[model samples]
Target: MAPPTSSVELATLGHRIRHQRLSAGMTLDELGARVGVAGSHLSLIENGKREPRLSLLQQIAEATGTDVTDLLSPEPPNRRAALEIELDAAQSSTVFRRLGLAPVRVTKGMTDETLETVLGLNRELQRREREAIATPEEARRANTELRLAMRRRNNYLPDIEALAEKQLRAAGHTTGALTHRTVSIMAEQLGFELIYVNDLPHSARSVTDIENGRIYLPPASIPGGHGLRSMALQAMAHRLLGHQPPTDYAEFLRQRLEINYYAACCLQPEHAAVAFLQQAKKERNLAVEDFRDAFGVTHEAAAMRMTNLLTEHLGIRLHFMRVSGSGAITRVYENDDLPLPADVTGSIEGQVACRRFLGRSAFEEQNRTTEHYQYTDTPAGTFWCSAQTGTTSDGEFSVTVGVPFDDARWFRGRETAKRVTSTCPDESCCRKPDSEALARWHGRAWPSARVHMQMFSPLPSGEFPGVDDSEVYAFLDRHAEQ
Candidate 1:
């Protein structure tokens, strides 16, 4: 199998090493002599034909009087250092000559304090320059930009996670389930009020009355000390982040996702989750149920936490899914660079996924279920996935978590070895039936139809049949005032 990495990156490293060697006035033979490697092998390294071991790279760097970091770092060593370098070089330009300024020189022994000072000065000047022509994003544009940003970022936001941790710490959040104390802390700290009612109109999970400084939720929102912590934390995040009323649907969706991520951070702190994953990863014993029990969260919640933390901490790529009882995908998150069979609109929601997949089979289950590990081999690669089928306030749903075969090494039950071939774009995988099987059973089986065929529409959409946006909006407006 190909390495679970990029050839381009490997090629880039080789080129960087070659460039450094030439700059040091060393031929392949000379560098190989210092590194104690063959000239032919060194040539391969210089030509991007082979990867060098760490010890060899160290020797080569030492031979060239350069640090190993100078050769291996894909980006600048540090942001402040890069800025200082730029700032120092700018003083040598013709523009600086016109200003009668002398060029600055950077030394190897430059202290972080000096670099920070340069960065501070640089940012201040840039801020001042922008102040004269400052333009803030309007709500609609802000939302659109935010959505694109999330897509580009694949929703793995470390900065937001860090801020959420700070907020959680300030709110006195501990390592367990969230409680009334969380709500009380937000109300006291943010000067907000929480009110519960029998039903939240418009089927909204929670609504905020910004003018009244009140947040409203349904009584059933939190079933236990465990539930609705995400909701409460999300509501708190909006206020904490100073997010204003959404100007457009994009903004609204972005704000919702942001707060939800903040809520997850509060529930499953990053450091703790990373530590847990590292341990599980080393043992190859990770399971959503185990995470849920360990973190005191639901199956779905645990699945989401794993997806968010794995990439950042363990370098494990994964895919997540939320499917309804009717084989419709409600939500998806993927960073594995694999193609998911989405609808014609380039969306998975409200679209029929592979019927043969475990998530789709979940609809027929009456009780909560977890599928045995299954593998999907497509043109892209072989992927292994497991799913937990569950129910929510609305109806039955399933959460499937997937990782490429290479990543399976870090998770539990990777040895299940249940392999399945999935060629997603083609219908033959699930849609086509064998002629002999049809001949054997088509007329032989006599199952009574419970519902009249005429009563069922040929095309059914979304989770619920009759729900409309305008109806939801009307209900929300009425509930907002209350």
Candidate 2:
């Protein structure tokens, strides 16, 4: 009421300017020189005793690497407005172009609320500490609870909105709105300060501003493309919900394994070992060494894949047998009811085992009767094959791929020895088969074989393969002469 208290307003402006100047490492005299004003006038302006002209303000802001609007912006109840202004300026600035992403805005109102809440919490904590009522353990527990609660709430609006923004940006979309209510709830759950949430706009296509952090769900009419939306949703869920234990880990592993195997199959088919299986499918012949060569995956990965294929895909109950003295079965992973050996050391590579037993008499018998079949080999020892023994399925011939061990080997030299040793009584050795040799074997095994093969063919001698550097240089030389 007394002259509208200009001093407080001037003081606030002065503080912001002073802070900006100091942050930019500029002295009062330097700032004054750049603004074309007297050092004393600049000092007075900072001390809240005088108001500088708009032009001078612009000059000062330019000198300090900021905008005139930012220098003259009225201090709002919250910092969100200030943040928005800053983001707007950044969007137009040269630096923003280099970043390649749109500048994100934080609002003054949201910042004020966040600061107030933090200050309140700090004060409460300090009071408790001063009263000798808050122990370190209590503080830790409180912090943990707070964090968990925040994480849970993060699924709601503002929090969800922020996450959606990130997701949109990642998906190569920009400029979208998220509903305020949705973002607020998500923000509340996630324990993030509201200032972070205020950056999102409300309503956008190709971008969403969700009200309650439900993820700015794409409208049903939009193409929501396969895999992309699901992936983004999963990412949003993870961010907001903090990954719910078993489900999260399982899903994460499943995705990781799928991607890993798919990439391996594409980039290095031999390493993935699928090439051998694919070859067998085409040629109707399978060899243990060929299996090993085509699927050059690690022993553990091979085992897991085999287990997955048999138990989940093929619906087969496989008894993993370990060959002991004289090819006698020492250990086995039979049905769940069958007890596992306490002292068994080695793991069977399931896929390899499946291929070995395929087309054998034992496998045929098992498929016909849906029962286990037993066969004896001097090198591999007595082996049992079963099909659909534990689970209901259409009775079909099943293969036993072996990760051959020492007892399975008929060879004597170390180089000729199989890569893996069997734990069966026979204790055969197994080795990766040579592809060329395996190809010849397949040709013989199936006389009228029509096989799909991927081979590395040698280049013909008449023409240079790919771009010939010498030819390219020669052409360039000829062009220059012309």
Off by over 4 Å in 2: 1-296, 314-316, 320-339, 342-482
lDDT per residue, candidate 1, 1-482, as tens digits? 12213444454556667767877998888888888999899878754468778888889889888877777765433454355445654444333455465555556587767766765665565444333321222222334455346556655788778987787677887576556677568566777777776656554666666776777666745556465566666777888778876533444567777888888887788877778778887888878878887777888888988877887777888888888886767777777855567533355455566876667765665555555577778768988888877766888788999888888876776887667777776767776667888888887888976673633332222222223556556755776665
Provide TM-scores for the models: 0.59, 0.19
Q: Cα lDDT of all candidates, in order?
A: 0.68, 0.39
Candidate closest to the true structure, highest TM-score? 1
Report model 2's TM-score to 2 decimal places.
0.19
Query: lDDT at 199 for candidate 1?
Result: 56
For model 2, where is the 10-residue window of minimal lDDT?
A: 199-208
